[model samples]
Target: MNKSILRVAPMVLSTALCTTAFAYTVQGTVTSKADGKAIADASVSLLQKGKSAKTDQDGKFTIHEDEQDTTSTGIHNQQAVGFVNLSQGVLHYSQSSGPVQVKVFDLMGNLVSSKTLYGTGSVDLRQGINAKGTYFAKVHVGSATQNIKFTTDGNASAYSTSKTKSALLKAGDTDKLQVIADGYDTLNVTLNNLDTTLALSLEKSIPPEPTYKFGYALKNTPTPSKGCGTNTTLKTDKKVENGEHHVVNVNGTNREYFITLPTNYDNTKQYKLLIALHCYGSSAEDFVHHTPDYDHPTPYYGQQVLDKNGDYIFASLQAVGGLWNKGQEDHDFFGKALTTIEDNYCIDTSRVFITGFSYGAMFSYSLAQDYQDRVRAAATYAVADYNIWLPQEKGMDKNLPIAWMNVHGVNDDRCTFDKAKNSALPRMLKKNGKASDGDSQFTDASSEILQENQGSTGHLCYDFKNVDERFPIKFCTWPGGHQWTAHDTGNMSVGWNWESTWVPEEVHKFFEQF
Candidate 1:
C-alpha cells in the first residue's frame, strides 16, 4: 500500500548583533520548527558583517565586525535526507524542504496513486502496505538528477506470531525491527510509539532489483475478442437451454455441455464466450459452480448473476475421457465445445476464452495452443505453468503465442508455486518468443509484483508483458492448499485483496481485458 505524509513546520531564525559605530558583524542561531530543537551547522550570513558564520552544535554562532545599526542576517540549511520506515503510515515527503513528487504503480500495471508535494507533510498508509505486492515508488525533487525508488511490502499480521489480528500490536507496545543496509548487512532497531525520528543509512537502491534477460519473438499481438471461429462458421442448432444439458454427437459419441446465456442477452450484440472445463473427477454441472470460487457460483453463470454488464456467454463442457490431455477425444474437446458455442450464441469470434482447475487447467493451456485461432486467452488455477502433460501427438504446438494468466498456491504440493515461477514461466516465456521480438523487447518484461499475505495465506502477483506483443501473461499466487483457497475476505486487504478467493475474481477481471 502507498501512503502520503502531510506535515510542514517552518524553521526558526533569530540573530543578535551589537549596534555601535564600530560594530560590523552579527551572530545568529537556527532551530527546527518541527521539534523546537536547534539545527547545528546551519549556514548564516550577516550582510552588515560581509561574512558568514556556521551554527555550532548548540545552534550558536558569532559573526565578524562590520559597521551596522543592527545585526541583519539570512540563514539557509542543507536539504534533509533520510529514510522513514513506512509500516507506521507516517510520511516524510510531506515535510520535505524542497518540492517532491510521488507516484506508485501496482504489479499488474495499475497506477495506484500519485501525489505532488510542494510543502505538505506526511500521509497514513495503513491500507497501503498491508499484504500488497511489491510497489515501486518514484520520489523526485524539482531536478531529475537525484530521483529514487522505494520498494515496500509486508504483512502486518505477520509482525506477530500470534494468529489473532488484534494481538499483532497496540499503542505503546515496543518491538525490535531489523533492517539491512547497502554496505552493512544488518542492524537491530528499537522504536517507540509513533517514533518518527528513526533514520538509517540508505543504499543506491533500497530494494535491489532482479536482473532480466532480453530478446523475444512473437507472432502477433492477440486481441481479447475475435479469435478464429465465428457464429457464421460453426453451423449448429441455434436454440439452447440456459441451465439443462445440451448434447452434440461426434462420430456416434454423444458430447454433453451446458450453455448459460448472459443475464441480458441480445441478438444484436455478440458476447464473449467462456469454456469452463472441470478438473479431474468433476463434471460439467460441477464446473458451473467450480469457477471463480469452488464454494459458490459466480456471475459467469447467467442463472446465477450478471457480471461485466452481462456480456459473456458461458459453456460448461465435460471431458470426453475420464482425464483431459489423455488422447485425441480428450484433445479435441475444446475445438468441439467452442465450435458448439460459436454455432449457437452471438459471440465475438475473437474473445473466446477458457478457464479450468487442476488437470483442467493444464488442458486449458493445451487447448489455447492447439486451437490458437479459436481461443484468444485462458486462465487456470491450482496449476503451474510448465506442468503440461501434452501427449506426444499434441506436443507439436509447443510454440504458440497466446495471452494467459495463472493462479497457484505455494502450499499446493500438486502444483508448486516456486517451481512454476522459478522454472515453468521462465522457460515457457523464452520458448514462446524469439530473441528478436516486439517493441517492448524481451528484456523489458513487465515484472510487476504485488505481494500480500493474510494470516497463513501469502498472495503474490507478477506480470510479464510483451511475451508476445499485447500478449502479456500474468502469474498470481497465494498461500493455499491443493483445492481452491476459501474466500478469506475478512483477512484480505481492500487495497488489492479479493472478495471470494483472490484468484477467481482476478481471473474474471483478466478475461475482461478482451
Candidate 2:
C-alpha cells in the first residue's frame, strides 16, 4: 500500500499542475480598423474549442479556459450551417448535412417546435409559436450540433449559436480566433498565447467593384444637354401643379410625361435622371401621387422621399391608353421622352436609370435591352419576358452589358416567377457574361444554389458573381404575389409593414451604387 500510494502521489500532483498551468483567461476588444471604433454585437469565436462570445456594447468580450469540457478530445470542426429568417415567422436552414433535426425553444427553454429536415428547408414558427420574441434553435446534423439564437421580429442572428462565456485552451496550444460582423470582413487569427488580452481591428467589407462598363463610366465626362438653363413646358391639357408636365408626339399620337426636378436645381450641374413607368391601368399622375395605403403615399415609388439630397431628377412616363403597347411605339415614345428630358434639363447623359412595376416593369426590362447603350442601369419589379414584347426581335445587342436588378415575388401568378427564373433572369445573366453552367445553376429552382435563397423576411437577393464585372446582375424574390410593393394584404401574413415599402428602398440603394 505504501508503494502504490507513493507511485500515485506524483501522478496526482502532476495532473493538478497540468490543469493549473493551462488555466487562462482570454479577453479581447473588437474595433473597426477604418475608424478605430468599437464594434458592438460582433461574434468572436475560438474555433478549435467550439467556444464563442458576443461583444458587448463596449466591444469587449471575455473567455475563460476552465469552461471547456476537458473530456472532449477531438477538435471541434466548424460546420457550414447557415440560417435566415423567412416570411411569416419561418426559420430557414441551409448548407446543413442530411437528416437535420431542428428544435426551437423560447427563452424559458420551452420547446416551441421540433422537426427533422431532410437537408435544407424551413420551419414555420407561426404553427407552434404565435408571439414575436427571441427564440433559440438547436440543430443536429449527423454527429455535429449547432445552436442558433434568433428573433421572430425579422432580425435573424448569425449562424453560430455558441454562447459559452469561456473557451478551453491547453498550454502552448495554437487555436484559431475568428471574428465576424455585418458590413465587415470576417477576421481569423491564430492565437499561440493565453492569459493575454487582445485588440482586434476588423476591416469594413468592400462593396463589389463597379463595372463602369455602362452608365457614367461610359462617358469621359459629364455632358450637359440642350435642356440646360431652360424651364420645362407643359403641353398637356391636364392641369399639373407639382411637376413639369409635357407631351411628346410619337407617330402622330401624344405621349404625356411628368418631370420633377431638384428644388435647388442648377443648370450648370449635371444631375442623374430617373425615369419611372406605371403599371397597366395606372396613369403617370396616379403613379406619382397614388397612395398604396394609409401609411404610404408612394411618390415615384418612394424614390423621391429617399432622395433627400436631391441629386436625382425624376420623370414619370405615361403609357399609351394606360397600357404599354407592344412593338416599337412605346419604345419610340421612350426614346423621344428621353431626348426631350435631355433637351430640357442639365442631365448627366451617362447616369440615366429606369425603374418600373408590373407592366411597367416589363417595359423597363424591354428598354434595358433595347437601350442598353444609353441607359446606365435598370431596376424593375414584377417583370416578365412573355407578357410584353421585347426588343430582341429587332436584334438585341447581347454584347452590350447593362447593370440590371429584378425584384419578383415567387407567388406572382400574373407575371409568374417561373418565367422570371427560367426566361428573364437567364437572359440577363447570359447578357451579363455569366457562364451557361453558372446561369443554369442559379436559374434551376431545384438546384442547391437557388434553394439556398429560400427564406427571407423581406426578400432574398442573389448577385450573379460569374457575370461581367462591369455589368452586375441581381435577382430578388419576395413571398407576396404580383404587386409593386409587397404589402402583406392579410393573406400572406408578412408581419411587418416595412415589407410593403422595401422595394423602393432596395431600388434606390441599387441605383445609388451605380
Candidate 3:
C-alpha cells in the first residue's frame, strides 16, 4: 500500500553569513518530539542542490557544502550527464564536451568495466560483471567528473563527488531543505547560510478521524427513555420473545421483524444491538432458522458467536415484497425499527452495528450512509453500489465516515464484483480520507489473483492504509459466486455446507473490535 506524506510548505529562516568564500558544514540531530527519542535513518535532503544524507544510529547527519563558481566549471552547468538503469544494467550518458570515459568499479574497489562513449550513448555495465551487488560508475568529461552508485536491485543512489558526503552551493545561496520519515509529518525549511549545528524535532502525525461524523454531534448523544431504564414497558405491538415475529407500522405499512435476546437477559443491563437484514425473497424467519445444508444447523450470520458471547441483542428485519427497492419507504421503516428498539431496550448507543448479504447488503450500505451518526459500523457480503437503489438523494450527509467491511466474490454474477470494486469500495475509502492514487491490494485488474485464491479454504482481505483510524475500511474477496457464505467446490460454482461457511466468523471478529 502507498502511504500518504503530509508536506509542509517551505518557510525561510534568516541566518548570519560570512563575507569570505569558505566551505561550511551543517550538522543536525533528528529526534521525535512525542517521546524525546532519537529518530535514526531519517532522510534529510537539500532539494535545490539534489544532495541528501541519512541519519546514523545516533540520529546525527553532517552535510558539507563548498562554495563553487558556477561559470568556471562544466560540472555545475551539467554539460555531461549519466543516467543509470540498474534493472537493465545499462548506463546512458549525454555529453556535449567531446568523448566521455566511463569506468565501473565494484564495492571492493576492483575495476569492473571501462568504455568510451562520444556525444550520447549507453554502455552495458553487465558485460563484464556477473555478481549481484553495488557498483559505482565514474564518468570523466573534459575537466569534470561524476560518480553514480547503483545496485543490481534496481536502485540508483544519487550522484556524488569524491567525498561522497559533500555537496556544492554558491556563497550566500538560498536553498530549500526537507526531512522525511515514517509516522511523522514531512518538514520543509529554507536556509540562506549553513555553518551551524542544529537540533530538529519531528512532530508525530495524528491519525485520521471518521468523515461521517465530520459535522455531526457526538456518537453517544442519544439517551434512553420511554421503555428503557426505570420504565418497564417494552415499547412494541407485542411482547418481546426469541424467534417470534413482531410488527411495526411504518407510514401506515406494517413491516415484520424478529428479535433474539440473550438467554440471560436483563432489562437494566446495556447491550450492543445488531440489526441483520435478509436478502431478496428471504424473510426474517427464514434468515434466522433456514439451514444452508442438511449436514449442519443454521449459522444465522454470527448468531452463533453472539450466543456464545451472551452480551448482544440480535434483530432481523424483513423487506416488503421480498426486495429492497432502495426507496424512501424502506429507509423510513429502518429508522422506525431502530427507534423502537432503542426506546424499549437498554442499549449501548455507541455500539450499534448492521450487517447483511446480497440485496440485504445493498440496503445495509444504504443504511450505513443514512444513519452514520446512529450506526457504529457495517459489515456485509456480496454488496454493490449499483443494481439496488440507494438513498443517495435522501439529503443525508455523504461526507461522514462509517467503519465499513465488505466481502465480495470476484466471480459473483448476481451483484457483480466490478460494481463494488469500482464504485462502492472507492467511495468508502475516499470518505475515510484515503488518497485516490494510493496503491491497493484489491483492484479491478486482480482477476487472476482472485481466481488463485478461490475456494472454501481461504480468501484475501486488504485493510486500506492512511484511512480514518476510528472508521477503518476493509475489502475482502473470495472465489465463489453470489452466496451468503461462499463455498467453492473447484468448478467455479457455489456450494453449500455449514462447516465451510466463513462469513459469519469473519463478521463476528470485525464487530467485536468495537
Candidate 4:
C-alpha cells in the first residue's frame, strides 16, 4: 500500500497542517469490553453538549471547540435556587500518548466505572454534568481489547441532579428531598417546602481488591512506641506503633491529631480512612519522623513500606497556626477534622485519602476544594498554585469526583517546580474533572509530547515522562533544594535526595486500582 501511504504521510500532514477555530476529530478503536482487542491506552473522550476528550496511543482523539459562547453554570428554575449560584472556567484532559483504560457502565450491563489511561492521539475530557441522562461508556483497549460505547444527553444531567441542600436550605420546614443516583435520572426538588423526586444514578463499582493495590491496609493491633514529645527525629531501625493522640475541637481551633490503627484493629471491622497533613511547623509527632512511624532519631526520608495487605486507618493532621493559607473562611478546618474522624473511627465512607507537605501541600489544595464530599483521593507535595494562596475564583464544586497526585521539586525555590510541576498540576487536572481544556485549548500542538528540562529554578521541565498507572502524576528531579526529602517514611534527609523507590509503593499502587 505505497509503504502505508508514506507512513501515514506525517499523520496526514499533521492532521491537515493544524486545524483549529473550534476544531473536531474523534477517530476511535478502544476495545475489550470483554473480548475483542485493540486498546493500547484507552481513554478516548469527546462528550460535547459541553466538553471532553482523551485518547491517543492509537485509540485516537482530537477536540477543539470553544468558540467563546462561554456561559455555563446552568440550572435555572426552583426560583433560581437560593440566591442562585453558578461558576465556570472548565476544560480538562490527559493522555500525552501512553496508558488508557476506561470502563464505566450504567444502562444495566452492571460494571459501574473505572479509569486510568494516558494519551494517544487526541486527549481532552472534563465533562462535569449535574443533570442529564443516557450514559453507558466502556473502553478497555488492551488485554484482548474490544469495548467502546458512548452516550451523554440529559443535559448536564439536569444540572448535576439539582438539590444543593434544597438550594442551600436554612430552617423553615427542612425536609425538601429529591436526590437521585442509581443507574441515573430523577431530580425534581422542593424538599422542605415538600415536593419529591430522587431517583438519580451512576456510582457503583468498587469491589475489585483481591489484589488490585494502591494505598491503605492496616487493621489495628500494635504496641511499640518511643517518640512523640519534643519532636525532630530521624530514622532508627523503624517501628513505633502506639498511634492515637487527639486534641480535636476544630473550626474554632484546638487541632493536633495522629491516629494510626490497623495491624488488625477490631471493634467489629470497619476501616479505610486516611489523612496525613504536615508542613509548616510540622508535628503529629513531627509527621511520624516521616511515616510508617520511622522509629525516629531525626528523620525526613527514613524508610517504610507494606501497604496493600489490608486493614488501613491513618490520620496525622495539624494545621491552624500551621495555617492552610488561612483564607476561604479558614477552610473549614479540614472539615472539622473530617467531622472528628467520621465521628470517632470505623470509617470507610468510600476510602477517604489525603496527603500533604509544604504548608501541608497548600492544605491539600483547599481540601480538594472544600472537602469534595469528604475526599476520596488527593496527593500533593510542594504545592504550586492556589492563586498564591486562595485568589479569587471562589466556591467551585463540579460534582466533586476527584483523582489527582501532584509532586514538585524541579529544583523548587519555595514552590517553583515550574509553577508547582508544570503550571499548577495541569491546572488542577482541568479543574478536577480530569482534563479537557482550561487555560484555553492549549497549543504548541498540545504540547509536543512534552519533556523538556533545565531547572535550577530558571524553569523548564514540561515533563509527562510516564503516566497512567491509573491516573498518575509522577515527576521527578533531584540535586536537592527546598528540603524534607521523603522522610514522610522513605527516608534520606541528610542533604536531601531520598525518593526511596518513590513513596507508598506508588501510593499503594495508585489507590489499589482506585
Candidate 5:
C-alpha cells in the first residue's frame, strides 16, 4: 500500500479548516443493503454536477455544493419507474404522457410480451412472462421510446436502477430512490436535486446481444459436452484451462471468458496478470494470438517476438452476452471472473493490470474505479466511456490508487482521440486533485514512435505523475484508427494484429511500476 496516505493528513486538516462552517452541505452514511454495514468509499455527491465526497472508513460522509449550483440540463437515461412491488409482482414506471406501448424481450432479442398502456402503470411479468435471466423492457411514449433492461431470479424481477427526471425535483429538496439489482436488495440513495446519484445508475442498463457463452460450452453443462440444456435463462458451470472457453454465470445467466498463459508458467512464482478485453464485435483469441494484422514495417504486437519466457500472465475476457460493463449483471460478471482468475493463478496482487480496445477500453475505467485495490494500472486504445461515468470515490482507495494510460488515433473515425485526451481524461484527472479547469502540466513525452509506421501517424504520450513519482496516467495518441499499439519489447510479444502503435514490451514496462 502507498504510505503516502500519511502525507495527505495535513491536506485533510487544511481542507476542513478552510471551508466555512456555514456552507450548505449534506451529510449521511451509505450502507450496503446485503449487510447493514457501512459501504466505505462510496460516493456521496450532488449527482448532476458530479461534485462528490468519499465516505470515510465508517461509511459516513459530508458533501457540500453551492445552493445556486444546482442545475440539470440533460435528460436522464433511465427515468425512475417508481418502486417495484415484489409482492404484487408489478413494476411501476412513470411516463410524462400516456397511451404508451411497452414491450418485453429476452436476451435473444425475441419479443416475449407487448402491451399498450393508457398511462404510467405496471409490466406484469407475474403473468406468463416470468422466467429467470436478463430481460429488456422497451417503453414507447408518443414518438419517444425508452428501453430498460433488467435481471430477475424467476420468482420476482426488478430493474437495476431508478431515477427521477431533472425537471421534477427542487434544488434544495432531497429525495430517495431504491435501486433493485437482481440477486441484490435495493440500494436506496438519498439524492439532492442538482446531484444525479440515481441518474448515473440507470445509464448502465443494457439492450441485448446476439451471442452468449458460459463455462466453455453450451450454457450450464460441464466441459466436454457439446449439446446442452435447452432453457435460455442465463446460467453456466465453468472450468479454467488453456483455450478452455470459460463461462461465468451471473444472475443465473452464463457469461463467456477466455484465458492465455505464458510459456514458462510456475505456480510458485508470482506473475503479473493482464486482463485484456476485446472490442465490440471482436473475438477473444484474435488479440491473444497473432492473426496477421501487423504492419509491413515494425509493429506493436503483430511483428514483435512472440516466444518469451512466462514473465507475466495474460487473460482475454469475452463480454457477457456480448456486453461489457453496461449493466448490473455485467458488473457482477467482471468481479466473478476476476475471482475465478485469482483462485486459479499465482497472481502478484500488486501488478494486476488491464488494457482494452474501444468498448473494452471504456469499461477499463470502471474496472479501475470500482476495483482499484486489485487493478494496479490501466491502458486503452480507441473510444473510452462515451457516456462518462464519474468515480464512486477519488481512487478505489486513496492510498492504493490505480493509474491509467490511453492510446488512441487522431484521424480515426470510430472513436475520436481528442475527445478522450482533451475531455474525458481531464475529468478523470480532476478526481486526483486536478483542480477544476486548472491547466495541467503534462509533458510531451512520446517514446519509441514505431520505427515502421513513420510519418503515417502522430505518436505522442502524456504522463500524469502522482505524489510518489509513480506515473499513474500515460496517454499515447497516434495518427491511426482504433488500434492497439503492441510493439516488440525485446522479449516475446503478446501476439498482435496490424492496428498497433506500441508493443507488449512497452505495455509491460508501463505497468511494472505498480
Candidate 6:
C-alpha cells in the first residue's frame, strides 16, 4: 500500500560544522511512490560551503571537508553544506504533474544545484572533501517537498554507493529512505535491491474517493427490480432459497456480492463457474444492465425469476479500489472472493471462466495471465490494447492454454483497438502457435469503428480466427468508439438470433461455439 507521511518533526537545523575529529558519512535509499517499492539510480548528495558529494548507485553518499589534520580546523565550527537525495519510479510519468525537483544548500545558506527529474531518474552531486560543514537538501514535486540536513568532516574518503548493497537491506531486498529537502515536506521512499521496478506512487494524504459507489437502494442500478419476484427482491434471504447477494469477509472486510446460478441448478447439481469484473466506478449490476437477457423477461414471465441456462455459475464481486486487484496487498481481496464463491456454491473445479468490462476487463486479463491454472478462459469488453499495467502476452511459452476473447470499439477514446494490435495479437498468436503472413497492422477508423484490412474484414468472422496453437485469443471490433454498438448489445442479450440480424445473438453464438 502507498502511504503518505503526513507530518514529521522537522530535523533540527544545526550550524554545528563537522570538524576533522568527527566522522562524516550519510546513507539512504530511493523508491517508488505508487507501491513503496525501491528504485535504483537515484543520486544522493551532501553539500556544504559550495561543495557537494555524489551518491553511489545504492543511493548512499559520503562528504568530507578537510585533508589537513589540524587542531585549528576544529575551530571553524560552521556547517557549510546540505544533503539532497533524488529518485523516481517507472510509472512516475503517469502522474498529471511533471517532473520532481531536487535542491541543495551549503551550511552557510548558499544554494547549490536545483534540478528537476521526470522519472525515478537519479543524478550525482558535486560536493567533495576539504569542505567542512553541514548542508541542506530539499526534494519538490508540484506542491510536495521533503527536506534533509547532513554534515561532513574532511578526513576519510567519501565513498559513493549508488550500486552497492545497503547493509540495511538483505541481498535481494531494498530499503526505504526518508527525505526532506530545502523547500518541501518529507518524502518517504522505498528503494529496491535491483532498483528496476516501482510498485506505486502516493501522496502523504488520505486516498481519494473510490471510483465506484454502490447504490443498491437506488433504481437504475444493477440490483434486481422489485417486479422480478421474491427471488429477485433486494431483501431476499440467502438461506431461504436460491438467490444472489452473499455477504462474506474479504481479508476481514465485510462485503456483499451477487451470484448467478446455472439454469439447470439443482441442490444436487454441480456446475462450472465464472467471475465477472466491473469497470472503474462500476458495480456488479452494471454487467447485468449490459446483458439484460440474463434477467428473465417481464410480462410473459410475470415476476418469475429466470434461471441461467448456461452450464456455469456467475459471480460478480466488488473490489476495494473500485477495481479487481491491481498488483497490491489488496489482491488478497480477490482471492478471498474466489474462496467465498467456491465455498458457498457447487462449482466445478476444472471449468472456471473470467470476464469483465473496462477495469473489469483489465482484471480479467490479469487473472487469466496470473491465475492460468484456475481459469479456463477469459473474455473482456472495451479493452483494446495492453500496457505496462496490463501487459500483453509474450510467446507461446507464456500462454496458459486458456481461451481468450476481447471486445473493443474502434472509436473507443479510452482504449483504442489499433493500439492493441501489436501486443495483444502477438501474445494471442504465440499462445496458439498460429501466425498470419499478412501485415498485422490495424488502422483506427473511428472511435466506434476500427478496420484491419491486412486480413479478413467482415461483419461477424475476423480474418485470423483460431490461428494460434495454444488457446486462441480472438479480437472483436465495432465500428464505433467506446460504445456498445448494436452488435455488442446483441451479444449482451440472450437468445440472440444470428439469422435475425441481431448482433447480440451472434455474439452469444460466438461464445457458445467454444
Per TM-score, the best of the predicted structures is: 2
> TM-score order of candidates, best first?
2, 3, 1, 5, 6, 4
Candidate 4 lDDT tens digits, 298-347: 22212123544545667776656666656654466566656665555556
Collision count for each candidate, in order: 34, 4, 4, 88, 27, 80
User: Which TM-score value belongs to model 3?
Assistant: 0.51
**RMSD in angstroms between candidate 4 and the native structure over all alpha carbons:** 31.4
TM-score for each prediction? 0.47, 0.53, 0.51, 0.21, 0.43, 0.40
Q: Is candidate 2 or candidate 6 better by lDDT?
A: 2
Tens digits of lDDT, candidate 5, 277-317? 77677656555553354422221222124325565667777
**Model 6 residue 292 CA deviation in Å:** 5.9
lDDT of 6: 0.43
Off by over 4 Å in 1: 1-242, 289-296, 299-308, 384-395, 431-455, 485-499
Q: Rate the local accuracy (lDDT) of all candidates.
A: 0.51, 0.67, 0.64, 0.42, 0.49, 0.43
Best-matching candidate per lDDT: 2
For candidate 1, the 10 contiguous residues with the lowest summed lDDT are 161-170
lDDT (tens digit, per residue) of candidate 1 on 27-96: 4444554455665655554333234566678766665543321112211223333222233433464334
Q: After superposition, how far is residue 384 of candidate 4 from its true place, in Å?
A: 16
Better of 2 and 5 by lDDT: 2
Evaluate candidate 2 by giving its C-alpha RMSD to the native, one decimal: 25.3
Question: Pairs clashing in candidate 2?
Answer: 147-161, 211-470, 227-343, 227-344
Residue range with the least summed lDDT across 10 consecutive positions in model 3: 4-13
After superposing candidate 4, which stretches have Cα over 4 Å from the reference? 1-276, 280-346, 358-378, 383-404, 409-471, 474-514
